[model samples]
Every structure is written in C-alpha cells, then in structure tokens.
Target: MQNIGKIVVVAAATLSLAACGQGAKTQAAAPAGPPVPPSSAAPAPQSKGRECAADDIKTTGKFGEKPTITIPDDCDPPKKLITKDLSEGTGNGAKAGQKLQMNYHLVTWSNKQVLDSSFDSKPFELNLGAGEVIPGWDQGLAGIKQGGRRLLIIPPDLAYGQGGRGIEPNETLVFVTDAVSVPAG
Candidate 1:
C-alpha cells in the first residue's frame, strides 16, 4: 500500500510538470508571428519580390517641401507622394551640406532584392556629397526636395562602379528614400 501511494504521487507530479512544460511552450510560440497592430485587427502584408519600376509605390507623408520637377520617366516611379502640405526651413532643398536624416530602403536594380532597410528602427543620418556615401547618393540627391520621398535608379557609374561594394560592384542600384529631416541652420 505504501509503495503504491508513493507511485501515484510521483505520477501526479510528473503529469503536473508536463502540463507546465506545455504551457510554457505555448507561451513561447505565441509571439513569433507578425506583431498585432494597435488600431487594426489584421497585420499589414509584408512586401514580397523586388519593388520594380512598374510597381506602384506610394508616399504617405512628407516633412518639409515638395519638388516642382516632373517625375522623370527614366526614374523609378514613386509609390506615393505626400501632397497635403509644404513647410520650409534653413536647409538647402537639393544641395548636400549638413548631415541629413533619412529613412531609406535599398534594393538591387536587377533583382529588386532588398539589400538594407532603416524603416523599422530609426532614420539614418549621413552627410550628403561628403564622400561618406556612394556617388549615386551624392548626385541623385542633388535636386530632391528636402521633405520628399524619392526613388533613385543609379547606374553602375554612380553606384559601386567596377569594383562593386560587397555584392553590388558595378551593379546598378535602386533606392527608395524618405528625407525625414535635415539639420536646420
């Protein structure tokens, strides 16, 4: 009788432990999917494939001003543009001078594979035309409005050139950039 009582207690304890382990596993797996949006019940769809020239990109907003030039046909078409308001500051609209803070998404021109992105965390800050960035950035950003979103299609000459930068040597580059903020004078 004593031995049987001990066996039953041990069995119950083992089952309790197994239940706890399963609970822990369920908790661990719950957060792996896409994060739930606060306002919407459904998660936003993740982008797939290369964001190509034919793709319709959209700009939802802008910070400062809008450019007047017609969107070049040769240039990659933007998904959207923020046309609601225009504001101004001390920074030059196109010239690269002080450091600019931007959120950028880069992809290979050939494959449209995303090479890097700074959308989730924070905007990237870099000095324009200071050789700190690729030649395409220095030149392509020349006439862009300060608070605008622009798509840059960079030929090899303006990008990695012959030697290429990492996997991008001599390859054409494509970038979608949001000029989030430029330093005020």
Candidate 2:
C-alpha cells in the first residue's frame, strides 16, 4: 500500500512538469505588416526551410507587449540552444537560483503554432536553474538582464526530449520572453 502511494506521488509530479506546454499545433506563415491581433488565424505552411538561427527568426513589437514571432516554415532545428537579446536591460544580470517573473510567447518550430503565452494572463514565475522548468529555459535564460527581451531557440534535447502532454516529440521551440522582474542577487 505504501509503495502504491509513492508511485502515485511520482506520477503526479511528472504530470505537473509535463504540463508546461499546453498542446500541439502546426506552423503558420508570417504576418506582413503590424503584429497580428490575438484573433488572427494560424499561418499557412510554407515551402522553404529556414536554418535554425537567431537571424532567421523575426520578432517585432515593443518590449513588455505581446510581440509577433514568425518562424520559417519547415525550420531546421538547431543542435543546441541559442539565445539572442533583442533588447538589452540595465542592472544585474539573471543567474541561477534567483526567482524570475516574466511574460513569454512560445511557438513550436515545426508547425509555427503558439503553444503557450503569459501575455494575456498573469506573468509566469520560476526559479532559474532549479529544474522548475525545461532544460532549455534553464540553460538559455542565464545572464539575461531584468527588463530585457530575448529570443531563445531551443532544440528538442533542451526542450521536451520525448515531448510532453501537448508538445510533439522532438519538436523545436521558439520563445520571445520579456524579463518583467528579476530581483538583485
């Protein structure tokens, strides 16, 4: 009976961790002009495959607002994690162990569909490098300054290895994150 209880606890913990990504959706085409409103439909698939690099992924919009992320159709996944600062922030840089409050937009590279976002609701909070989130977030977010906006291109190993609840297996991830606050440490 005690062993069964322990198994249940472990299963519950695993489920909670895998809940990071909500669901799977296909990629879409990029919007032409201003950022697309939240009500816009998903983009259509394109033929060209863009290399997995910061230069190829386009982000538009001011910091602290919901930005537009346009991933090339059939984007080749990177072998490792890539972090690029779209806008630099002042003050101390973020390090492991410090708590961070942030708003982010996440999309899967394979389908270019939005997997999750904190812009419409409350900001997401996490302790850096504490295994509270995916390995990509832990490895990619280090040294980002408060108030800065960054782009993280994460391959499968850094994200969900075998995939999770809603994420497809071995799917690459693209994120646009704004550091809402990271207390001085």
TM-score of 2: 0.72
lDDT of 1 by residue, 42-152 (tens): 443344543334233223334422222222223442332222112332345756676778777676644446667677568888788898887778776654555667766
- Over 4 Å off, model 2: 1-50
> Which portions of model 1 miss their true places by more than 4 Å?
1-92
Alpha-carbon error at 81 in model 1, in Å? 20
- Candidate 2 clashing pairs? 26-111, 27-111, 27-112, 28-43, 29-43
lDDT of 2 at 59: 92
Model 2 has an lDDT value of: 0.85
Q: Name the top lDDT candidate.
A: 2
Give the 10-residue window scoring lowest on summed lDDT in candidate 1. 64-73
